[model samples]
Target chain A: MGIIDGKTICQVALVVKDLDKTVEEYAKLFGVPKPEAFRVPEESVAHTQFKGAPSKTRARLAVFDLGQVVLEITEPDEEPSSWKDFLEKNGDGIHHIAFMTDDRDAAVKYFEKNDMPVRHYGEYEGGNYTVFDSKEKLGTFVQVKYEPKK
Target chain B: MGIIDGKTICQVALVVKDLDKTVEEYAKLFGVPKPEAFRVPEESVAHTQFKGAPSKTRARLAVFDLGQVVLEITEPDEEPSSWKDFLEKNGDGIHHIAFMTDDRDAAVKYFEKNDMPVRHYGEYEGGNYTVFDSKEKLGTFVQVKYEPKK
Candidate 1:
């Protein structure tokens, strides 16, 4: 049987308040090209695995070059977004660390089988993403996914 | 004058409810071995740093076998530890992602010059640390520091 292994965190997603300013700061600080910004309208919110239940969440996303890993920041328009909650409650910090996986289902299963608590926000054509609530286990949210790419 | 380059995330610290249990989980799930475990009771809290903080906030730590880096988990037996607050508010999420800097003062100055809001958590003998309030910048707190193990 093939063995299972935990992969290294390759990306961190930060929920920000303002998208344009955020991207601008990163570009200047890292001295890298400005990140291409995109808007995920309210309709796409349900499909993407975000915090809380499926609801309207307008998001502006940008990715900054960080060598091997990229820092992704998303500013949501509604409900203060999960990023705001984290910032206000705990102060600004690393939002979520993502580990790449070949098979998200298998990855989720592996963690579940190990008695890890897992929560799935939702799944869309892009991918089926789930959050391994590692807060109890690791003090971080580990996101895993395996599906078609956009 | 020698100019410093970019800052890179050096270490991620966490506060765990149980040191032994936390170490065991990572070792078993990630195939990483537990590094030597020790108690640093002299700290305001029962602590041990990833490699040992020269100032304070030293935490009980277990370095991953791969040496990808160290994971410092602090537990407070006396005063209310910052680690405890992290766990309570975020529920086992990333407490802080530390970015290594050649000149912590310079980085802070750069952000300050930009009118970016900052919360200086002060410095340790081992390194200087501060949380750049990036809620409007990156939607997360960027922890910057200058740490060199002696």
Candidate 2:
């Protein structure tokens, strides 16, 4: 089996300049009610890390659950995070495709062994996620999210 | 209903520098055999049009069928197609997310009415497709492919 199951892709994320506008546009395009954009929780809650150190990286985020996969739109703050870096360098574009993993550490290790090291890591209410620098090989960053069973 | 059914996303396509390398890496990452890259057919067969005029834009393409959505990789020629333009301006990255549509022209008109015009149009063996300049609002190009009932 592959280190990461590509078939389990759960989300495709984009970094944008305007979170509200993009959310509205996507809602209109998809004929869904416009979902509100919410800010990522404070560092005390999210425990975000950039590179290898704790960082105050946060963003305004919105999601559209388009049945098969969730679409994520993020507008990052001026902090040193992967989202901010990608937005600054590539403008509004796809940032990463994320897959759900039962073992986030193992997935990260596999990617690291292949020379795609972690760029950012963070936690949310239900799960933690890691982004990898897989752009050189995959043409975009890859993310693995782990949410344990309740 | 939305003009285009976003839930029907059939493909997420990326523009890359090396089609073979990307395909191989993805195969390794997914634990699948590498799919061969094939050059897009000649204009006579593809009937390609860019910005409303007949054009000879082509690319080497490969795909990974990841169940819910197909992942497409393209290495465009130095032609004036949307793929080439995105590669030149943005380097290697996600180019478009495509939906399967029964009425491709109407979908194009819907996007055009919302100020997103067609960037490219082409036909293949069993279907045709249109690419739109939806990046201004949607943050990336959107495509609709139509294959008639067999």
Candidate 3:
């Protein structure tokens, strides 16, 4: 269990108020090619993966080339959406740092013992994800997104 | 000037509440080692760094082995503290994500051209930092932390 528990951070998603406007600014400011954006009717967010979270997010996102790494900006479409909530409560800021893992069950169990519970569970396309409410653990949300062959 | 501009993500720091408790939870839950914690008298907060902000905040923090690409947890020790204001306004959550560069002035200029102004600025043991009120740029704070020697 402990052996398969190691996790890698796949992508860091920043919740924005407007994805289109933000994407344009990033492309201009960062010299990053405009990233394709998607809409997740389920999550009520439009996102784009960094050549990564593409279809899964259906998420409206803008990708920026940050050296070798890719920066993904995700904006939620719903009014009371998670992105909006984070912006309203915290004011536009860093939202969640996502970690990719192979053994998600083990990862979730590891955190569960520590008093941090899985606040949200999601599965999209070939991806399985769980957001550990970092509020109880630290002060952020630790998102464990995994690829599960179903 | 524009040719030297590079896109990079250096660090993302979070304002956490209890260092000891948060550290313990991180180690046990994510299989992340107990981070070395320290008090930054100048920064006015107790924090750590991430070796990998997504995989681990191997924090180069104030003291101990408390560094990792960390989920930094900061508490207020005094007023006029940026970490404190972040906590009070946002309630323990992800604060800001910083991108490092060789030239600070150039990076600030790049953002300013996009209508984002440098809001807060600071210097630390590691390097010099500037906060772009990306609220106008991308609805978040894009921090530029640069190493002068580079």
What would the TM-score be for candidate 3 when compared with the true structure? 0.74
lDDT of candidate 3 over A16-122, digit per residue (tens):
76778877776666565667886554542323232123333344656665543346687755433445556666555567767677788877787776666766555
Best-to-worst ranking by lDDT: 2, 3, 1
**What is the per-residue lDDT of model 3 for residues B40-116, given as tens digits with 9 covering 90 to 100?**
43333323221111111122242112222334455545434545556666776666666667777778777777667
Q: What is the lDDT of residue B17 in candidate 2?
A: 89
TM, every model: 0.68, 0.96, 0.74
Q: Over the stretch A4-47, how does candidate 2's per-residue lDDT look in tens digits?
A: 77788888898999998999888888889987788887899999
Q: CA lDDT of A91 in candidate 2?
A: 86
The candidate with the higher lDDT, 1 or 3, is 3
Over 4 Å off, model 1: A1-7, A40-58, A77-93, A114-118, A121-128, A147-150, B1-7, B38-57, B65-72, B76-91, B111-138, B147-150
Of the two candidates 1 and 2, the one with more favorable TM-score, higher being better, is 2
User: Each model: TM-score of chain B?
Assistant: 0.61, 0.96, 0.67
The global C-alpha lDDT for each of the candidates, from Candidate 1 onward, is: 0.57, 0.88, 0.58
Q: Given candidate 1, what's the lDDT at residue A124?
A: 43
TM-score: which candidate is best? 2
Candidate 3's docking class is acceptable
